[model samples]
Target chain A: MGPLIPNEIITGQWDFVIALLIGGAFGFVLEASGFSSSRNIAGVFYGYNFVVLRVFFTGMIVAMVGLLYFSYMGWINIDLVFVLPTYLNSMLLGGFIMGLGFVIGGFCPGTSYTAAAIGKIDGMVFAGSTLIGIFLFAEFFPLFEGFYYANNLGNITIGEMFGLSNEVIAFAFVVIAIVAFYVTWLIEKRVRKNMTEYKFE
Target chain B: MNTNSSAKRKPNYLNPYFGGVLLGLLLLTTFFIAGRGLSASGAVKLSVVTVVNKIAPEHAANNSYYSKFIPEDGGSIMFNWLIFGAIGTFFGGMFSGVVYGRMGKLRIEHSPKISKRTRIIAAAVGGLLFGIGSQFGRGCSSGAALSGTAAFSFGGLLVMALMFGIGYVFAYFFRKLWI
Candidate 1:
């Protein structure tokens, strides 16, 4: 009954409009959560701030639980949900690169945009660099084409790989998130006590 | 010193846990309506395709990577859903900025230990690497890592693990830039 466009429940030229509204909400949340600041975002690694961890893990757990519940009630069909396909080697390599970028740039694509909106020059530079980086990738696509399409694993889920139900995995995630939150809280308190340069805005 | 002084007057942001819940709810709604999760890097990819198509149509078409993005019927690449979503992200960010009194000024943000030039250069390099990596990984933090893992995707978990794992590994070296 849901996933309006894909299921023909809400067809027509309005799909893009719906996507925009959702994207807007996504952006608003990121900005309001202090993700607009590079220092705030980078603080996750330093333990001065753990906003990124809290929001990211919480959002993940909430969505995971929500989807499971929706399916249980038959409010939405889980079968129709899009699962990102896996390219094991490529994903691992790409993720490593993105991590380096995250630490170096201090902003991911989504956060950078919000930071730029709030007038952070580093955010602007990060966004500009994203565009340039993408351009560079496109220009040299041929060189990496073989690896880009390498190690196809299809659209498999963690549950499938682990031989567990989605509910079990979701439950584990919640537990892990809770533990992470508690531990990070302790760490942040200790780290903030020692740090003299950075201050919460 | 000016930056630190300005930061003092800024209002406190929402509690991280509270903000996380809000963000989680927003992500849940996205799946309920659109049947997918949120993304940011895909939009940048769309822009890249659009630009390449405009500058060198034949070259873009001939390239396997760019060709996948080009429409068979020949239309503007900017018409993509991700591109529109990115535009919406810009507006949404701006709207939040307006509400929070965070807009209307622009300046480079850097550690007192580092020069503005060093920070800018690092940002550009980081962005360039991230852009290329997203293509290989099939998504960045938002697409592959966050949304994918949320959906319980194996690939997503791998990306998330590697991304954060590598970040921690490299964070020490980049400590001067940030901490």
Candidate 2:
């Protein structure tokens, strides 16, 4: 009954429109949540703001549980859903590089896009740099092509790898997120005292 | 340059928990319809491909990275789902900014301790790193961390962990730019 595109319940013509609406909602959520600010995003690291951590983990667990439930209810075919493939070494390398970027740049790709849309010059610069970076990668892709394609662990999920049922893992993440939310709140309180530049409204 | 999120007539940002739930539901809906989660870097990657193809047709044709996305069926490489998603994201963000009154002016966001030039350099360097990393990481925070973890992908989880974990580790060195 779902995954309308692949199942052909919703024809190919509607693909672009649906993508637009979904992306719009995604952007709207990020922007309204204070993700348009570099400082706001960086707060997770400094402990002045835990908005990023809270929003990120909450969204993760919610989607996890929702997907599990939808699959349980037979509302969607789990197999048809796209699972991000794991390219171990390459991904690890990638994540490492991106981590540096996040702290230095203060916003990631999605957040940066929202930031740019909201008239953030830094966000705009960051977005433009990504284009240049990609161009650099494409041009020099041959140098690392061997390494990039080296570790291809096809379409595997955490629950499958750990031998835990989806529900159990989903519940674990929910617990973790709850604990994190509480702890971060406490941390933010202590940290904000020293931060004269930022105060929660 | 002053964000001053103080008590103003402007609309305040929504609660984090609510925003999370909305984002999650949106991701779920996206998967429910397109069988994929949201992403931003993919669009940028394709955009690069399009530009390279236009500027240096022979070079793009020969390059492995650019050639992969050129479309054997003979059309613009930009005719992909994520590109439309990126377009929607721009307008959606703009709409929210206008509604919240957060978009009247353009400025560089940084900590008071850091100079504008310092902030700009940091942002450019950081963005440059992300661009290259996304190519390797397969996506950025939204693409890999948030969307990846939600889908429970192993590599996605790894990327998420490493991205945040590393941020925590190296944050102290770059404290001035943000803090």
Candidate 3:
């Protein structure tokens, strides 16, 4: 019933307009939460800042619960929602590469763009290089085509794959996220106290 | 530092949980309306396709990956919703910066222990790596890790775990860049 665009309830022309508003809110929240700062982003790895983890996990669980609830209430059709397809091997390697990039660069693409918008030179550099990096991938696409498209799991959700209810999985994530929040909070307190350089605002 | 004002108050960020909730709600709204979550990197890939097609029509038309995005009917690839979304992200960030008073002259952010030039190089390298990785992974942190996980896809979960897990594993090796 929902997903106005797919159902033709919302005209095609309005799609881009909706995207802009959604992306704007996405960017606004991320920036206000200090995601525009690379140091704050990097804190998740060093234990001095768990803001990234908290925000990511919390946002995730909220979306998950919201989706399930919407579906249950018949406000939306869950199956119509897009689930990212899985190419197992490629994604694993990709994650590894990005993980290394995260530590060295201290900025992800989204945060980097936001930072660049605020005139952070490092953010600008990172954003530009990503374009180059993507260009390189396209240039060498043939070499990685087999592996890149291999092991496709085909938009499968965890519930469907594991025979668990979506509601159950969402509840588990909520619990895990809360536990992680508490543990990370303690870790941040201990870590920040020892760091003479911790930015106190 | 605000040169215009005499106030020395440090930049105050929104509460993390509150920020996360806001982001979560926005993400939910996106899915409700568009039936797809937000993405930062997918838009870049689209732009890359458009540029390559324009600069070297033959090359983009020949490539397996780039060709997939090239329209057979000669439609413009730049009109995709994701591109608009990316532009919105830029303006939104600018708006937030203006509100928070964090907008400043171009400056390289880095650890005090590192040189500005070194930080620049690091950022360049990182961006390049992330760029390539996002392609392989089908999305970056925002699309794959965040939205993917929310949808409860195995690959999304796997990528999310590995990305964060691997970051911790490699943190010490690159501590100088951050701490």
Candidate 4:
């Protein structure tokens, strides 16, 4: 009844059209939320603006809870949904490198694209660099080929990792996110009071 | 540049909580309809493969990396879902910009302390790291971290934590670029 494309409830060019619409929603939400600004994004770290933390955690928890409800209602087969495969060491190393990039560059791949779309030169440069980085990785594929495929944990979920049900974990996340949001709001107030260099744009 | 300074004082963005709810619902809809969440880096990867395939057909054919994306059907790699999603992202961003009056004018954003040249250099270097990292991590923030965490994937959680954790650790070092 759901996952219309995979379930054959809908077929053909419709999926492509849906992809565009979904992508649009994704982009609009991101840009309208002030994600197009590097300063706004960087503020999450400095505690001046907590928009990134708020939006990111909220989005993740909402989807997590929604998936549970959908599965419970049998509206969609949860098993059919794509769960990203985990490769421990590879992701750890990759995530670390990306973290450095985020602090320095001020945009992730998705956010940067949205930034670039609105005529931000910095966003455009970041996007172009991402291409160069990918090309470099491909060019040096032979060197890291072994490491990339190492630590293959296959498709695993946090529920499996923690031996808890998805609903329980999601509920826990909701609680954690609320606490974090409250704490960050407090921190942002304090940090903004002392800041003379950066202000919300 | 000065015209932009006068064109708009500031953009009125939506409330974070409201925007989050909308984003969350969109993500939920994606899972319900497509059996997956959103992504961005995958499109970039595809474009890289396409370029390599075209520029050096022989090298791409012989290489272990580029060859994987070279379709046996000789179809366009850019026709995939992620690429289309990215294309939509462009339009969606523009739509929001126009509506919010945030569009029009290009500028290199950076701290007043840093020159435009320095800002561009830092951004490019940062972007390159992200690009290479995504390949290793299997996705970037949107794909691997955000979507992955939503789906309750272990790898997603790991990437999210480590990425943010490292960002905080290194943020101090790169403070000048932003602050």
Residue-by-residue lDDT tens digits, candidate 4, B60-88:
98889888887888888888888899999
Sort by DockQ, top down from the best: 3, 4, 2, 1
TM-score of each: 0.96, 0.96, 0.96, 0.96
TM-score for candidate 3: 0.96
Model 3 steric clash pairs: none
Tens digits of per-residue lDDT for model 2, B35-139: 879999999999999988889999999999899899987887888898999988888888889888888588887788888889888889989999999999988
Higher-DockQ candidate of 1 and 4: 4
Give DockQ: model 2: 0.73
Model 3: per-residue Cα lDDT over A75-117, one tens digit each = 9998888888999899999999999898889899999889999
lDDT of 1 at A2: 67
In model 2, how large is the Cα lDDT of residue A64? 90
Candidate 1 vs candidate 2: which has greater lDDT? 2
The segments of candidate 2 whose C-alpha lies over 4 angstroms from its true place after superposition are: A199-201, B1-11
lDDT of 4 at B11: 58
Candidate 3's C-alpha runs over 4 A off are: B1-10
Q: Residue A18 deviation, candidate 4, in Å? A: 1.0
How big a share of the true inter-chain contacts is recovered in candidate 4? 0.82
Q: Write the per-residue lDDT of candidate 4 for residues A1-201, one digit (tens) a residue.
A: 777778998888888899999999999999999999888998887788899999999999989999889888989898988999998889999999999999989999999988999999999999999999999999999998889889898999999999998988899999999999999999998997897666467
- Which model, 3 or 4, shows the larger lDDT? 4
